[model samples]
Target chain A: MIDPVLHAWGWEIPVYLFLGGMVAGFMIISGYFTLKGHHKHSDFSSFYLPHISLFFLSAGMFALFLDLEYKVHVWRFYTTFKFTSPMSWGAWILLVVYPMLLLNTLVSIPKSFRNRISIFDRISDVINRYPALVKNIGAANMVVGAVLGMYTGVLLSALAARPLWNSAMLWILFLTSGLSSAAALVHLISPDKTEREVSAKADNGFLIFELLVIVLFLVGLVTSTRAHKQAADLLLTGPYAPVFWGFVILAGIVLPLIIQLLAVNHKIRHTPVAPLFVIAGGLLLRFVIVAAGQASVIP
Target chain B: MSSRYAMVIDTAKCVGCMDCVVACKTENNVPEGYNRDWIVQDVRGTWPTLHMEIRSERCNQCDEPPCVETCPTGASHVHDRGGVVLVTKELCVGCKACIAACPYDARFIHPDGYADKCTFCIHRVEQGLDPACVAVCPTRCMTFGDINDPNSQVAKLLTSRKWHTLKAEAGTKPSVYYLT
Candidate 1:
């Protein structure tokens, strides 16, 4: 039966997308600093970010697991890989993410944080000996990070059945959103002033790009076809408008971006407000998009 | 010859009797409040100039099935016999990606933890019988056969009638057609 309302997904997917996006941001940030040889001023990028990302990634995986109806059949995802299926790609990416996160910690580990575990310390000592391999690992982080970020949106966009998520621009929007979120978290939690300033500045830039992508996403939808126009309306004037405009645009990106821009210019003292808002906004964006996408019908 | 099964439904002949719906439900043991097939009554224009189309709809069983392409575990697949879409429960992870990918709104997450939908009664078709819905259609409006066989009724109907597939713009190349 063809019905007007869609109802296949719920909160778990949005939460998972949000966490996955943040994890991607951390990897990109860490990779950037490690490759640039400026990790000394931003230990958060190399060391803490990976650990935090691991925690978040694990939680995100747990959320995905919870969303699965046949919990025991979860292993079926690994049995065969479908190139056209985003879930298959995501599963393999997630499996490799663990090693990448672990390898990242050992590459440029701070001494004070080392020797806590005998096995880890020995492995870290052995791995740190190879500078070239370590740098390659850093590069891998960025590449894998980027793929993971885009895959979250690609997962939705590949479903041509849902017009709202069918855009080619969705992956770019999600990737940018993920990078911005990672930068915001680093800005908020990093101890080093240089790291804070660098990440805050980057966050501001990403936030600006995210806003642009969001605008372009709707425009792309509205201008295409009738079903697509209806999808755009779901966010513009439909039920999802308030959360999209109020939380994602106003509170999430615009306000945080404004605060960070001021702080970057030394117009105001740095505070936790902006970064927190950015992170929350990133989460809200996923929820609203997923919900609205589900609500959009082909008719 | 390779068989490409298709269903040709005459909208002009169908009276919205719902016999097909009930037959499919009982034949498939579909759970309550869920259906493997259903009726849609679409009325256009005002009361003085009304044009009504009553369609008994189910899965389109498309040639380029999104459900098959999007299934991570190879659970949703096309039958080797006639390109009929079927979901194998043994490998299904119950992710509902198929449900989201189906533009027809045909699939549902089965309570037993797998994606479920109208299979066109593949078992019955395999046993050399008409599908329950087609067999029981009161007006004899539904014709099911291999469209690849030019001699088949379905193929003949398609040639003689002015018919259209739903959501043709979706590029699914649906197997079902509605004859005007």
Candidate 2:
């Protein structure tokens, strides 16, 4: 029946989780900017990045679909709501993402862009008539974004069998990492000088916090049962160590973090390499956790 | 009281012949390279102080089955008949959440894309027959009955013997018990 860990989830899941986390990160950043009225000056937050989230989300969903053994039964996720089921909650949460995205897009874009589409023009006119509602939508985006980010990690921790993922710290680590990675992307692409510095500063803080969370995560496992200790070893000294320590930690976290910190302090100029490393590290974080968690046994 | 089925295996008597496995495969039409039940030989201690415990294991049919709880769809559910966990093939997306949630490792994916596992032979049980595994167990080490009934053989064995369930710390409250 169980065959130990089953190891059913593979690369597709990690890729999907990574993209989902990134998409959540984008939502939070866009939402924060919209609320602060920074959207008026920031093209990346208002027009481009939010729309790019849609494309990334679609790609993630496609990867998820590919992993399903019974693709036709995918619709069954909506047939009923199992409150205890994280997958059920994740499916419904994903549904909310699209409408929230489109609605926010209608209100956040510049007048010139909205004027290009007649339908968008009418919708934005109706939506813009109430600035209060627009503000509320901005807040909703951040709330939903936080939930999405948490869901990516919560689903794994919910599986008590896998000791590697059975920690409350996992979701916090994921959320911080998501935010930091989003900030890195913003810093890399945003044209506005003020916005670029603000995001880079935020990223510096997030990276430091993320590193702390990662330590707490490992500590949580090592201090628990022997089963959990062995699970931690999968990342620490086992087969997954090279990638977890080498790619995700050293290259992904430490390298980019040092670069971003220097850039944030104005000691050095921002380079594309650091942001690229942050994004790549964010993705590898998911893959290593998913794979290592699958390899962990209950016994 | 509602019927609560359970399995009690006497590890002291079991020889790990795996008759229960073959019978289960054949009776349930289980595909090759998969099983609903199997034997586990746990060897503890070192060289001269070795202690081997051979027991037949299957789905714990936990009262708090995480497989059913974590199932994205309602595919993995408990049967009303005796709280037996079963999956509806049509509803399973095979996302493998149930597979990961279960610590007992009592489930496997059917090549047909459904989460397949020991069903306690509910069909045969309904006909007043034991599960295929229990019936074919060569040592007669396996006992099957409703643990809810205080007078049932399983309940009596569990009450009288030194028995333990796998992953007792997991809080799954498994229905299967092993008597040492």
Separate clash counts for every candidate: 0, 6
Off by over 4 Å in 2: A1-7, A110-112
Extract clashing residue pairs from model 1.
Answer: none
- Candidate 1 Cα misplacement greater than 4 A, ranges: A1-7
Q: What is residue A130's positional error in candidate 1, in angstroms?
A: 2.4
The deviation in Å at residue A31 for candidate 1 is: 1.1
User: What is each predicted model's overall lDDT from 0 to 1?
Assistant: 0.90, 0.88
Interface quality of candidate 2 as DockQ:
0.59
lDDT of 1 by residue, A1-299 (tens): 43322237778999999999999989988987877767655567788889999999999999999889899999999999999999999999999888998888876677787777888888877866777777787899999999999999999999998899999999999999999989988889899899999999999999999999998999999999999999999999999999999999999999988888999999999999999999999999999989988877788
lDDT of 2 by residue, B1-180 (tens): 999999999999999888888898899999878888888889999999999999788889999999999998999999998899999999999898999898887888888888989899999999999999899887899999999999999999988999999999888999999998
